[model samples]
Structure formats: structure tokens, C-alpha cells
Target: MSGQQPGRAGNPQVFQPLAADDPTTVAGYRLAAKLGAGGMGKVYLSYTPGGRPVAIKVIRPEFGEDPEFRRRFAQEVQSAQRVQGLFTAPVIDADTDGAQPWLATAYVPGPSLADAVVAHGALPVEAVLLLIAGMAEALHVIHGAGIVHRDLKPSNVLLAADGPRVIDFGIAYAADATSLTGSGVTIGTPSFMAPEQAAGRKVTPATDIFALGQVAAYAATGTPAFGEGTSHGVLYRIVHEQPDLSGVPERLTELVTRCLAKDPEARPTIAEVIRLCQTANAETVLRRPEDWLPSSVAADITVRAAAPAPVQTPPPPAAAPAVAYSPTAPVAPATPPPGFGPPQQQPVQPPVQRPGTPVPPAQQPPRPYPAPPAHAHAYAPTPFPAHQHQQQHPQPYPGAPVPPKSGGKRGVFIALAAAVIFTVAGSATAYVLQKDDGQQKQGSGGSAQGAEQGKGNDTTAAGGAAAGSAKPNAKADPKPADFKAINLTAGYHLTLGDDDVRPQQGEDGGYELSYDTGGYLDAETSEGNLVLLDPGQEGSLAVCRAETRFAKNIYLTKLAKGRQICVSTGTGHMGLVTVQGFSPEGSPSEYMTLDVTVWRNAVGTGSGSRS
Candidate 1:
């Protein structure tokens, strides 16, 4: 083992690039070079001698310390093998019980959502709508299989030239399984998590919807829903506060707003989201993205060939082709022996191809050979059967659920914690609510009656307003010619509960801001700009005060990273508002406020109370 350097730049051993000759084979496929690295592991550009390419992921050393993590990792690998979708990066190979466990999937060529936003700023409204619809469709398939991609954020979304594809199901959830991150800590990125997930409660499809909303916010404003902040601060806001959507495009604001709803139940289903996005026409998507092609093809026909062919019963020895090698030919799996607790999983062996055959078109780039049939490997129950192939521990095949090891300390602790929390939290709330029901109902009813009367008065007032506008100078306030000319600068403070970064000031004196809100707040600016966040529970409003007239519009677009800062028009008047508080579950952004607008008339000007 090499000695490590603490934090110096020239730590010879830190992130050294892999040499061409370095052994990087997985299953029978050889790794050609290193692609990139992240928190969990290093990603390699691997290919079979036949030329098929794959992106292989190798787990990092730190994660290996926890046995529980390893177990969960192995399970996730198996589950990934079961996923089948054109938009999904399907698993091609894996070896969970090897010295250094590794998994491989067909390589995808595209920019991540984060990279796209950084390079191109926000996408056009139409493109954003397509992105949302495509992503929602992808999630529909994944969630249906009973898997929850606990970490769905911009980085995880790959915007291929053709369309969007989701990657990294390393910590995905199965239909009936506990999350890899148990109680006492959060797992997925803080910004993209649903409110309940932040509270360490159970997560479901609604949680995914919340994450999608954050993605959409990024599309609109080049930011997340909760705004940029420390992971802790972002989580705090997601669980307790609302998002600020001042600049989101009117077409996508509603869709993105729904995605950011705090109550998971209130969020739309993935399929519904897809439909809404398609109909929104927020912006037009470009052409379909590129697709993968088989690595090798016959020179004359251009026909595709399989990476390596599947195993078949051997016939006469004389029938063997020159390239043919027996399974017992003794090729070692890539990587060295382990020094850790248990051995990592082994990679699958590459299949043997038939001589002179053209590669199948389906075996192209994004597409690889179909996954190994269930139980293709003989090392299920026991991870490493290398030195001795034990017979008694016959393991179930891949796709078959692995039983939880009985009585693991971590499992016991989790179960106990869950029991205690549920009993107290559930019982206490039920008891209190039931006891207060009678008095609460009476008060609630009275409030409802009063609210109705107030609505009637507002309607009457609106009618009078319309009539007044018809006749000039009827004592009604005149709409200003333009928004107040406030000279804008760089620093402006806008906060949701407690976020650190604030909004930037525009050269024109106006400020652009955005926030993620699960509930609506009829916020009145001291200067007369009225902004609404998540109106009616899951809605968005774009408010801007240009001159003396205030303008607003209801927004309706699914969460995508390209629809923020759209102008407010059509609904009432005309003004521009930029998105404000953007945050995701795992990686939320910081909140920013600008000098935009203020409502002239509202009953309460002091207390931050709800209407």
C-alpha cells in the first residue's frame, strides 16, 4: 500500500492517472483508461478486446469500512441488473465479492445537467419542458420497479444530445427494503430530498417528485430550489420552510412548484408530471439525442456484432474456433487480492463470439449486450468462492432477494429507534389532535365563514376596480408607466428561515430572486410588489413592480433546469420576476433576494402571519 499525503497538491499517489498498460479488466472486459472519480469510487473507461466500451465504477476504500454499506452496495448492484429501459444506463457487469468490488454499465456520452447549465446558462422554456417530461417518464419506470433513486439531482441527470438519461442507481431503493442510510443520519443529497426524507421519515414516489422539482428549478434559474447553502442549512429549509419562485417562467412555474411541495402526498405522480410537462410547451426540445452503436461491425455490411457471444454447449474439439478459449483457460479477474474484511464481488466473464459474424445493431454504444440471465454466476450466497467452491451454501440467483443477515447490531438499533420514535410521535399527535377537535372545529368554522365574507368583499372590490379603470380618474390608483427605478448593485439579503448567500443586484436597479416553497405566502413588499409562493399549496406566482403597476401570473411547468426568470404577463399585467430560493434534497443552493416589488395594500403589514 502507498503512504497517503494529507492535503498537499503534489501528493504523488493522490489521483494518479492510470497508465495504458495498467490492468483494468472487469469480468472479461478490459479497462482502457480512467474516466473520472467521485466520493464513492473511481470510474474507468473499459472495453472488451473486441472493442465494446463500458464505464466501470470501483468502490472507494473509506466506504469499505462499514460492513453494512458493503451489503447494501451489493444489493443495489443486483437491483440495478433488473432495470430495463432505453433511457436508463443498464448494468452490464459487476463483481461485488472481489478484492475491490466493481460494477460496469454501458458508457453514455452527454453533459450532466449541472455542466449544461454552467456552460449554456438556462435552457429555453420549450427545451426545459421536454426535459421535464422525459425525466418524469424515466422516473415512472424506475419507481414502478419498486426502486427509489434516493439521490436524484442535476448532476445525476445526463442531458444527451438526444434526450435525458438518469445514471447512478448505486443507492437505489427496492420495493421492500430499508434505505442504506438508516436513522440518525440522512443519505441522499440534502437539496433534492423531500421534506419527510429530511426529517428522517419514510420516503416514497412523492419524494422523487420533490427532487424533480428541484431539477426543474435549476433548469429555470440555473439553481436548485432551496438556494445554495451548507448542507445543514439547506436541509433545515427543505424540512421547515417554503421555496421562493419570483423569476420562474410562467409556463413552468406551476409544475416546478408542485415538485417542491413539502407534503409528498400533494405532489403529482411521475406519469402525471410527464403529461403536464408535455402539454405545457414551456419551450421546445431540440432533436432526439444520439444513440449507441455496437463496438465492432463487419467491414462490408456495417452490421453490428455482439461484444462477445453467449456460452453454448461445446461440440467436437475440432469445431473450436481459433479465438475460442475454455472457461477453465484460467484468466484472472482484474485487480489484486483484498486486505479488507470480506472479498469484493467478481466481474462477469465476457462471452465468446462466433467468428465472422456481424455485430447486432442493438449492441451499440448506449446499448450493451442484454444483462446476464438470472443466476448466471455461481458466487451468490458466498461472495468469494475462489480457493474453495463450497457446495452447501448454494445461493439464490441474481434478482432473487438476499435475506437480511439476522440480528446485525445496526439492524437491531434501527428497529429499536423506529419503535420508540413512532410510538411517541404518532401517539402524542393523535392524542392532542383528538382532544382539541371540538374546540378546533368551532374556531375553524368561524374562520372559514369570515374568510368567505372577506372573499365576497374582495370580489365586489375587484368589480368596482374594473369599472373604475373603465372610467379615467375615478379616484382609483393609476397603473404606473414602469417599475420604480431602483438602482441595483451586487449585494442583497434574502432569507428563508436561515440561508447564507443573498441575491445579486442587477445593473438596472431591479433584483432577481427565487425560493422553493411548499406553501403559498401572499408576501407584500414594502414598495408594493405582491409575490405568491406555492399558491393554494402547490402553485407559483411571478410578481414584479414596473412603474406603479404590479404584474403577476400563475406558472405551470414541471421542474427542469431551464425555466427561471421568465417575465410575468398575460395573467394580469406585465413585469419580470426572477427565481429566488432554489434548493434540492442532497445539494440545495443558497437563497438570494433582490429589489423587485412590493404590494401597496394588504391588511397586515407587521406580523408574518398566513391569510
Candidate 2:
């Protein structure tokens, strides 16, 4: 596959630097990176000498020389020129009769529908509806020009921050063009083809509707309507069998079923489809909110930067609640992050600094009492609400102990409960965290061990020793904490996708969230702030006690608009970071912010994700 991937360079890693064999420029535009390559030819990410981004598909040598293909290509280009729709990636420029036969379309910055579903499973019902409607609208425009988009499938549709866009009309034909599928040189996909197209019969606009049914089924159920198999079998099923809508939702079954009808006249027209979609979804929004994609798929939106563009503000510090411990204390009077162990020896001073010393980002120093090492098992005491007198550190002087109470039945009950609740006659302040869908299980990504496995090899800093180093005072491995969460929408949704929300640079040693692909969190630059971490290494997240580096595998997939993730500010305070939401239906406010709850001091709780 040599042709430029038309329009999308969603995966930043896939955008390879220009090769020696590649052209310095195409037509007049300068080629930046290779977008895609296939049987057709290489597609390059280019800039019009005017600096406009475009996916330029340069046809392969063999196809360009075919006399028959040349005529068909020229006519299709003319047909493509007549299409213009909010949902279609319009063909802005082309030269079908030129030496290489190239075409350019406006760039859509998110992953293709296929890539999104493959990486994150089925899209939500609302997302699928919007997709169907958008594609239907695009078809309305496509057919208006008398063009039949002969090659319509998931990959040809991109999930942009704005909406879905139809791309790659490589096999499209004018209403009167010759067949491109008959006589063995099939240009369209078999699983999604119309019966007429599969039987080498006349192709028409309804051909696209059939494919739309297949695409919708795939989007809603994460599988094709026609089962997967060899080319011959799939096409055979398309021509003579009933579609399997088993996984589709009930309301949509009727709609897609009609589109997949074997008889062209029986299929719904593009206009009818738009009307049906709007009627069925009268409550739906014509356009999706900015946080339209899951973080995993959003990470693949590489046409622009996808990282959060926050200013370089030093993350606030975590406040150490008032509490103190004595030498060789046991699990007695302290509240911890969860999964903490009782003290085994002399009181250990947590790494807390005076007001003048600089602190790291995304972290808070553990209370200045005996604490466990990164891997040490910890005993978490119940939250001790502030009010009762308690020491902030191991006190040099001892405190009084409460005598067992003796009274009547009612007073006896109170005495018994007080004995279980109090220790050394003290009360301490407790820190409260929000909880939502419990700790968001990480995203369904390439690997679950990415972060957990790394923690095993991570060096611990307790007792002034690195993770693997031996320290006589190193605390034993603390049991992981029960991560807390809350809906990101609790803080009214923040719409940062607008171009006006530019990113602010950081100050010395402050927290910074960066993205390899641009627009990650620069809502304007990248529809949202989504950073795709390097696949094999530790990522930069200011979790833990200030400037704690996060492991690669702990990231979540979908981040909703206006959601905030709170972590230890490494000071005595917690830092709350909010990422923009892009949910199509704008409900269930999922926060896509970097979730530090999963890794308080890199303990690695709830490290896996559900697909």
C-alpha cells in the first residue's frame, strides 16, 4: 500500500519522516510525513504552499497507466468535485489526468471509526446514531451530485472532534460510469457491498445505504452485520443471505435492516434515512460536544497536538492532617490513603519540607509520621474526623489514655463504642476523596502489564534508597489503596475545544502535561487534551508526592468534557485537573483527566481496563 492515507494521520507514531524515495514536494505542496500506503499508493501529510493541511493520495504507478482506470478516475474526480457537506471531507483539489493522478481532501484530526471501535470497543448508542446521521447527510450531498460512493466502510469514515466525515472515494463512480467491480478487479469491500454491486449489476446511490447498514451494525455492536470470512463467502452472504442484526439495539434493528435489503428498490433512500434518524433521535444534538471520543481513540488524533495545554502552574500541595505517632507504634491512630500497614518500628518522618523548599508536582508528602515504603503493606485506619486533639508528629511527651467507661445500659453502649473508636485520647482530621465508577479501570489498550509490571521494577525511595536498593529502615510493601473517584461533570463542564483556549507554558519544576501528537489538551488545537504516552516507557504525570512519573499502562480510554482528576499536590493540598469532554450525547460525564487515583504514589490499584 503506497498511497497517502487520505486525510487522517491520527496515529502520530505512524507519521513517518519523509523518505529518500518520497518526493520533496507533491504538485506544489511540501510533503511533511507519510500518512498511509496500500495497493493504491502512498498518501502524504502535506501543506499547500499556503500551509493548509491535507492528505494527498498519490496513485500507484500500475493503476495510473491503465487506460480504462484513467477514464474512470477522471470522471469520478469530476463527480467528487460536486459534493459539499458538513459531514463529508470535501475533495478540495485533484488532478486525475496527471502523470501520478493525485487528490487532496480536508484533514479530519481523529481516528477512523474502525480504529476507534477496535481500540475501545463499540461506540455508545448516541455516538452511533450521530455517525449514521452524519454519514446519511454526507450521502445526501454525495448522491445530489449523481455520485455513487462505491467504497463505503468504517475506515472511510473518520471520527473528528466536530463530527464524522466520509473519506476515500477511490472507488466512487458518476451515476453513469462503468462498473469497477465486474470481471475480477473489484474495487469495493465485500462484507459491506450492496447485492447489485456484489452480483456485478448496476451500481447506484442505494449501494451506499447498504454499506451504511453494515457500518452502523459495526459501530453499535463492534462487529460486522455479515460475519467475517474469506472474500468469496462474505460476498456470497451479501448477495443471497439475511443480515445478522443480533448485536444491534432493538430500536436500530428496523432501520439498518431496511438499508441492507437485497432489493435496491426496497432500501431506504438517503433522504428517507436522514428523516428517520432525526425522528428516532429527536432528543439528540445535531452536533457532538467537543469530547466526542474516548481517550484511547483520541490519543490517535494526530493531525494536531492532543495533549492538555494548561499553564505551567506548580501543582498545589497536599495538606498533612494533624496526627502524631510514637516510637514502635502499631496500627493505632492515623488515617491513610488505603492499603497502609501498622507501624513496625520507631516513628518515621515523612519527606515533608518547610515552606521555603520547592516541592514536586502531582504529589503530597505523606504525613510526618511512620509511613510505609512504595511496596510496603499498609494498615488503613478508619477516617478520624478533625475535632479531638491529636499530635501532628511523634510527640516527645506521652498523652493520656481513656479509662474504660462504666454506666447504665444507654451510657454503657456509648462507652463500648468510644473504646473501639478512640486511641490515646486523640482525634485527627481526615481527607475525603470523591468516588464515581470506582477507580476507572484503565483503558482497553495494548497491554495491562504496562504499569503494574513497571512498578515491580520501580525503585523505592524510602530510607534514602532507590526502589531495589536495600535499606535497613525500608518499610514493607504497603497494600494498594482503594482508589476513590467522582463524576468529572461535578464541576460544571468546561468547553476548552475553542481555539481561544491556548496552552500556557510552565515555570521551573512545575507540573506539565505534554503530548507527542499536537492538540492533546489544547481543546482548540486537538478537539481535547488527550496525551498518548510512549508505548514502552514511564510517562510524565504529576501524581504521587509531587513530580511522580506515571507508568505507561495506567491511562484511561474515554475522558469526558469538564471532568477533573484530583491528585496529591505534593504540598499539603490536592490539585484538581480538568480535561475537556467530547461525549456526543453529553451525558454520564466521564472525566478523561489523568487519573492519579489509580496510582497514589504508584501503588498500581485497578490497573486494568474493560473493553
Candidate 3:
């Protein structure tokens, strides 16, 4: 395996300096710098004792506290260690019993498929073919070890000089083990999920095949096959709509389509996918060319592979203060590190005085660490403040007299007198114009009704007609009443039928409510109809009346805050449920809170609506 050299110069863009809260060393290996962070943990660049570089992933402390997660994590690490192939990064070491579990993998110094595509557009057809073949081989090895990589996306694949390397098995699980869906959290990326995976059904090796199709399409084209939007919208399309493969090259279209089949049984296996790639290339063994990647992309990989400088820990303060630390105590201000953290405020200083003049009270000396210069690295050590470089003025001749002030007080008085005269003259002109306008109105009509008509005409001519016309309509369309906020949990059922709109626990089937994985809330009764509104649809009774189709389940995973959902109850009442917020992620007591507004009358009698 190729890796970065430990003694080379670093590129600030690739390797950020360690943060104040970041640890300098984990176990026996010394952390060189921060690589990046993800939802579950932070990845750091480190060197082995033999001077070969490795990437260490430290799991988040919250996840470490969960006993179930710890058990699953250890099992996954053991399985990942078994996966060995030419196109995969192998797990080198791990410690699952520590306070914070961490695993180390051989670091492949190259830009990810996602970053490369974003930086240099889509890859050529030849490059994409190689990518698919390499990824399919890696998946074969992973599945051979009885593991399923639940989260497979473009970001997890790295582009190496030799071939593509698949990395990051952080969420993989044994194929026969129980899933984590019981906790109401779906595990895979929304855009690349298979139909069964999006519906929270059984995920098999076929699930990764569906993701492989999406990845190939993305590599050939610059956008996702299902297109991009909210997670709810993307997942819905993946489950119900056909993928958009318009930009996919004609030669690879059929094979990619087969892998994306909605039915898992219909999709091809990993072995067959490899066969198709070989057939398309017309080679029993696809050999890579000397210039496999585009010139621009290869140049970018070369720049990122350059090793970064080792992080130097700042020395501790020479004399410590005697104050004890407390959680509630006000924190003393410290200078922010070079490139990251909030910007520091420069102190306000008094104006400079002449040498002969008495100085005002002197302010405290400037802070030892000054604000960083523009474009500094986020994690670099703070540099010393630059010396003041202001050029000094030559001293005046000893006997020379100071120049006299020019028009000091008299000029100010004249300007004020001129402004007063202009103000009086302007006010007189305005009074004459007002008097003339009144005379014209009186001459035109003497009756109050006629004068009012004349005023209306003038207002219309001045483009203020909408203001006069809009008031009555606004008054006629008053917002509906009976709005209530309901809190729903796993065992609760939210009833939108009567005046009272509250969630009840353990109701019968007619009024039952169940929350499932992928943000699905099921109201499994024959009485009411539910429809998730389209993006930007207004949340109102009228929208519910116009909705012709209703669903048994509503996916709220990607619904934006304040987005509306239309629903009709068994009691012939219509309502719009707005998502207020959800419980903190990974919380044991996970729940969703909704603000529902119900109307007494039901409108259209389409599919799910009650007459």
C-alpha cells in the first residue's frame, strides 16, 4: 500500500492544524494534523512507528456511551479486519474498549471521487468504467466476509494513482445481524438508497448493488440519478419514480439500469456487474493506461498527497493564576487560533497626541497574540504580531511657528445662517402650494360626496389603487381557528377529529399512530387520508381539498421546518399539520412535535377523503 512520507512539507489546504480541544496523541501514535470530520467522528492523520502514515478515526463520545452501539462497533471492526483486497483499504488497528472507541486504517493519499468530480467535472467514460469495476471487486470482498456496507456513496471512494480505493466501513454490519431501524433512524445516504432500503425493508447484498448503479451514474454525469432536493423528496423519488439517466453514456446504460431495478431479486449480483464491465470494455482483464485520470485531476491528487508538517504543541503558561475553574464561572478571553474560531475584536485606542502635548491615560499594552492574516491555515500555530512599520514625519525646525487656523468659527456661523434662511423660504413655498390645491378642490365641487370622488381619482392616478382595494378581501378571508400543538412519541396516537387535538397512548386500531424508520408516521386506520404536500405547497384547508391522492404513511425525515402536511380525519374534519421540530438525534426518548390546524368541514371526495 502506498502512503504519504512523514518528512515532506505540508499543504495547509489539505491538513488543518489541531484545534484547542483536539488531542495531540491517541494511544502510542502521535497525531500529525486533522484530516476532516463527519457525523459520527473526526479523522486525523498520524504516523506509525515505522514512519508510514495512517488515518485514525475517533468515534464521538455520545455514541461511545451507548452499550448497544459499542457491541455493534466491536463486531463491525472485527469483520472489517477480515476484508482484504487490492482495491480496498485494510483496517490496521483498533481499540473498541476505550473511553472513546477509535480505529486506524491505511491512509490512501488521494482526493475522494466526490471532491474530484466537483473540482474537475465528470470523469471520462474510460475512467468511470475502471471506477465501477474496482468498486464492484471491493464490494465482493466485503460481502465475502459477511458484511454489508450500509452507507456506500461517492465520498467513500478514493481515487488513487493505481485505481479507486473503497474506504470507510464505519456503518457496515453483518448481513445476518439485526438492523438499527427499531430506533427510528435510517442508516444510508438518501440519494443512493435502494427502494427497499428507503422503505425500511430488509437490506441485503442487493442493496449495495443499487447504490453501485447510482454511483456509476453520478460518476458519468455530474448530478445524482434521482436529482437533488430535500431528503424526503429524494427518498420518495427513489422509491416511486424512475431514475434520470439522460446523461449516462449509451454503452453503460443497460448495465446501470439493471443494478437499479426496484425489485432486489431482479438486480444483478456483484459478480455479474463485474462481468458486464469487462464485456463493455471487450477485455478479459481491464488494464489501466499510463494516463488513466485526466491531466487536471491527476495534478490535484499530486498536490494533496504531499505530507503536511507535524503539529507543535504550544508551551504552557510559565506562572499559573491561582483561580479555580468552575462550569458557571465567566471564561477569560483567549486569542483565537490562526484560521479557525470566531474573529477577535481589536481594542479602541485614543488618538495620537503631539510630543509636547500631555497624553491621556495610557491603555493596556496590545495583546501578545494578534488576529491572523487573511488566508491563514485554520489549525496553524499563532504567529507573533508584526512590528509597527508606520513611517515617521521629520521634526519641524526648532524656531518655526505653527500655522494659524483658517476660518475657524466664523465659517461655521455663516453656514448655519444660510441653512436657516433656506428652511424658512421652503416652508413659505409649501404653504402657498397647499392653499392653491384647496382652492382648486373647492372650485371643482362643493359637496362632500363630489370631493371624495375627486380624491379617489387622484389616488388611483398615483398608483395607490391596490391599497384601497385589498382591505375588504383581507378582512373577508380570516384564518381558521382550532389550531393546536401535539407532541407524539413511539406509543402515542395523535387524534385530529374533535376540538381537542392531543396525542393519546395505546389507542385501538381505528385511532392508532406508529412512528417508523425513515421519518415515517403511520396512521393505520381506514377512516382518514394522509398526503405529504409538495415542496413550497401552502399548508391550508384549500390545499387538502385539491389533493386527489393520499398515502398511508408520511415521511418526515427531510421535511423542512414549517412545511405543511394535509390530512383528513375519520370524523369528516380536514387539517394541516406543520412540523415544529423533532427530538434530539440519538435520544432514547425520540419524538416529533407537530402544530396541527383542523377545520370542521371536509371538502373534496377524491381517493382517501371521507365524503
Candidate 4:
């Protein structure tokens, strides 16, 4: 592939002009231009007080509106600040409490590995080796601080003149913290995900090792180890099939294979990965050459590094007087630079009036100008003039009476008659509805009283028919025996030892239940008390009770919302838990909300029916 391309003789294609809606300054740093935007937010180019370039990622406004996201974002920023590796972009500053959360990292002025690989073909074997070594070292330092670079794709690795720099830990969470995965969301790229991660299992430092293998393979072959297609298909292949490392260099095949092992434990550790690279380089310390990257990649990096500094526009003088404009005077429009001017518009002409007619009052300007079109391209130029003016027009006062139309009296009479008729009809309907509601409430009260009186003898109930009959009613409104809904955050424990099931922060008690980041419901000490029914088997509590085999934990991977779980609590109460839904991914308080129904003293009797 040809690497030679046009240099930055003028403005570089990488640096885009700031749009009108884009903020020119965030916190104290003056934003120079737009670097790029992603799902999380926009990244702007800025400078520190010392004139060092930095990239500021301003989070999207919607995310800032969520208090849970703000908390997690602050935690991630703190963890990122602790990353002090040579080959990683360190977070130098952040403001998580601001209206728009943002964090700044030392800018690495170079093309990303994905960009370089796309521009030029796969790198030489030696370059790939060096790349792997640097990344391995970066991960070593990151994992040491109890962090996992969860999303370690090629695009996150920037190739600098010195070496590769890992960046963008936006999704990275603490190793011991809860996994960010939730229903309908995947934390990492499918092609780079370890088997466990793709299967919704627990993620550890070894997960990053699997990603490192994928990155190395992609860098050597210009394609992912798992061929790309739909995300589901790719994830399936990552979990169930071997990687396609045919095009990868022969020297790196064995090491890449080990790294891409299906079992996380089978993959080499980060330190071992570094040692493997050294061994590949003839059993000596791997040192970077002057031209560690291929010639074309090196030239691209040089162009990016040598890009001229952006020109800073001085703020407008505070004391300048507003310029006045006369309607009768003709003025020349100022010329704007190419690709940076507003669309042309035809001038509006004044209406001619009779000689005896009085002049109309001057109009007021519109309250707010229309927002920029949603379809406008990111690179579309906005109007850039020293001053802008709006023609003002008079506005009618609020609540002013509108002129009557023809047959106004007839229309008013019809409206009044319709309103009176509707009012009478509504009152009559309310009276009838209230009467019916009172009757239904009386019937329900009788049923509740009967149930309370018979509670002592109702413990010995059985059969699937009774449970199935009550299942439909449970969806409408849970019965009196149902426990209050419980919300269990990841890494927290839930105990059914008491009459009320409540979530505990830690697994300090010998409880029958706890949730894990892997989407599993586990019974820490009370094994064999929890049973997960098949999809269609959920309606029958008898089947749950008769189940001879029980697992210590049940995986919720791919489990439908509102699915039910059966558990015999430590207090000899049989309960049915209906999972409502999981909290949004990346939420600081990621939790699973469950509605539970309990049958007191019904565990060993096989007598607990939903009814």
C-alpha cells in the first residue's frame, strides 16, 4: 500500500473547525478545534497553561444528567489518574461535578494503530513485536493499580514516534469493581473480547491479555483474528471457534495462539507476554530502533507531530460599543474566508404604502434564532462575522384577544353547549364507577380476611395447577404473601434469612443469595437451595419444589426480562423471584430489581403453591 500522502500545508484534515454549537472553552482551558466525537462525547483539542497540547473529552449532556453515571465517571477518572506508565496517556485533569463532565489527557500526536494499518498494509514482524512489548508494559502498570483496560481495541492504541500509547479508558473499571455489562449492552468489542467476556462471564486481568492477542494479530495481518460480520456472529466465533491467524506472521503465530486461548486461565499473564516478546527477539531485551515503525507509518507520524499549532483568536474587547445600523443606509458585506461563510440570502424589500397612510411601528427581533439543522454535516462552516444583526419586529402582547371569525356567536354557543353536556356525562360516569369500585373493594377485603384467618392451615399446599392459576394474577398485582421488591446492586449480597428479603452491601452473612458481576445469582453458603427453571417451566412452583437437582448459582446470561427464579431460603420459606430488569450499563449503582413472593414455612413440606 502507498503511504506517501499530502502533508499539512494548511489546516490538517484531522483537526476540524469548531461548530457554532460547540463550546470554545471548557473550564479554564481554551478549546482550539474539534478532534472527534464518539458515543460518550466530543473530544476537543486544547492546551495547558504550559502550552502543552491536550485532548479534552466533554461528556454528552444526557450522561451528565444521570447521577449514577457521574459517580462512576468520577471513579474512572480517579483510577485513570493513577496510571503512570510510559506508554499510556495519563489523565492530567478532570471535572466530574461540572454541568458537562470532562477529563483531559496528554495528547499523543500520531495516527492510531487502526488508522495506520488501514492507510498502509500490516507492519513488519519486528514492528509488531515492539508494539506488543510496549502495550504489554502499559497493561502491566495498569493492572498493578487494580484497573482493567476493558476496551483494548486497535483504535485505542496510538502509534507515536517513540512507541505506542494506550488511550481512551472511558469504559475501563476497577478490576474489583462491578462489570459494566448490562442487558442489551456489550462492554468490549466483540472481535477483541475474551471467550468469558463474550459469554457474559466474569472478567479479570486475563481478559485484557486475550484482547492483546487480538490486537497483535490484527496489527500483523491487517485484519481481526475473528473475521468480522454481525456483532453476534463475531462474538459467537470468538467464544466457540478458533481464531483465523493464517495471515499473521509465522514467528508470532504460536504466541498469538496462546493469547487467544478460549480459557482465560490458559492465556499468558501480562508479564509472561512481555517475556515471550523478548524471547521472540532472540532472547534479549527488546529495544526500539530509530525507525521502529515501517517507513510509511513513520512518515505519517512525522506529519502529525509536525502539524503547526492552531492560531488562537483573542476574545472580543469587553468595552466595545454596539454598532448601530440605519435602514436607509447601504452597507458592503465583509468577505469571509473560503468554506467559512453563511449561506447567501436575497434582501427583503419594504412594502409601498399610500401617501396618506401612517407608518407602522418598528418590529421586535425574534426571541431565539432557530437551532442549526440536525442534518448539517460536522464540517459544515458556520457564519463567522465580526458582528451579526437581526431585524426586529413588533409582537402582540401575551393573552391578547384574537379577532372573531364569521359566525362567532354561533360558534361560542355550540362550544358552551358541548362543554355542559360533557361535564354532566363525566359526573354521571364517575358516580357509576365509584359505586362499582366500592363493591369490588368490599369483595377484595373479604378475600383478604379469609386468607389471613386460614394462613395457619394454608402451609401444606401443592400441585402445578394451583401455582399456574395464580401466575397470571401475580403479573397484575402480587398477593399479600409476596415480599417487597428488592434491588440488588452488583457485588452485593441478598439474604432471605429474615421475613423481608433485603440487599446487603457485602457477603458478611451466611445468606442464601448474592449477585455477581457475571450476571449470576449465587448462594454463597446455602448451596442446593436455589433452582433455575427452564423458560416454559417458570409458571409452576411445584416443579421448582420437586426439582431434585439444584445448582449453587444460576447464570442470567441471555435471560429474558421478568424471568423467575425459585429459591428455598434459609428460614424454610419458599420464594419466587421475578427479575424486573438490570440497571443501565456503566451505572455506578448497577443493580437488578426483583419482585419476590414468599410462602412461609413451606421448604421441606413440598407444600408451597403460589395460591
Residue-level lDDT for 558 in candidate 4: 37
| Off by more than 4 A, model 1 | 1-23, 170-187, 282-611
Candidate closest to the true structure, highest TM-score:
2
Worst 10 residues of 3 by lDDT: 385-394
Candidate order by lDDT, highest to lowest? 3, 4, 2, 1
**lDDT-superior candidate, 2 or 4:** 4
> TM-score for each prediction?
0.43, 0.50, 0.48, 0.49
Models sorted by TM-score, best on top: 2, 4, 3, 1
Q: Give the TM-score of candidate 2.
A: 0.50
At residue 213, candidate 2 shows an lDDT of 89
Residue pairs with clashing backbones, model 4: 363-392, 363-393, 363-394, 364-392, 364-393, 364-394, 365-392
Q: How much lDDT does candidate 4 score?
A: 0.63
TM-score of model 1 vs. true structure: 0.43
lDDT of 2: 0.53
lDDT per residue for candidate 2 within 1-611, as digits (tens), equals 01224333234355666778988677776676776675456777765554446777887666777777778777777777778788888788888788888888775666778767876799877777778988998888887877777878887888876688887664445212333334444445677888898788988888889999899999999888988998999989888889888889876777888888898889998877776676666753455555556656665654333322211335689776576431224344433332222322222222323444453431222222222345432332332321121213212222322223312232323323333332221111100111111222434321222223225433212211111121123223223322223222222222222222222332122322222122232212111122332211233223322333332111334333333443432212222344443333545542333332222232222222100
Tens digits of lDDT, candidate 3, 406-494: 12233223323332332332222222223222323344122332233335443321112211121111011223556546767766676
Q: Of models 1 and 4, which has the larger TM-score?
A: 4
Residue 228 Cα positional deviation in candidate 3, in Å, after optimal superposition: 0.5
Query: Could you tell me the lDDT of residue 363 within candidate 3?
Result: 20
Candidate 4 local Cα displacement, residue 499, angstroms = 97
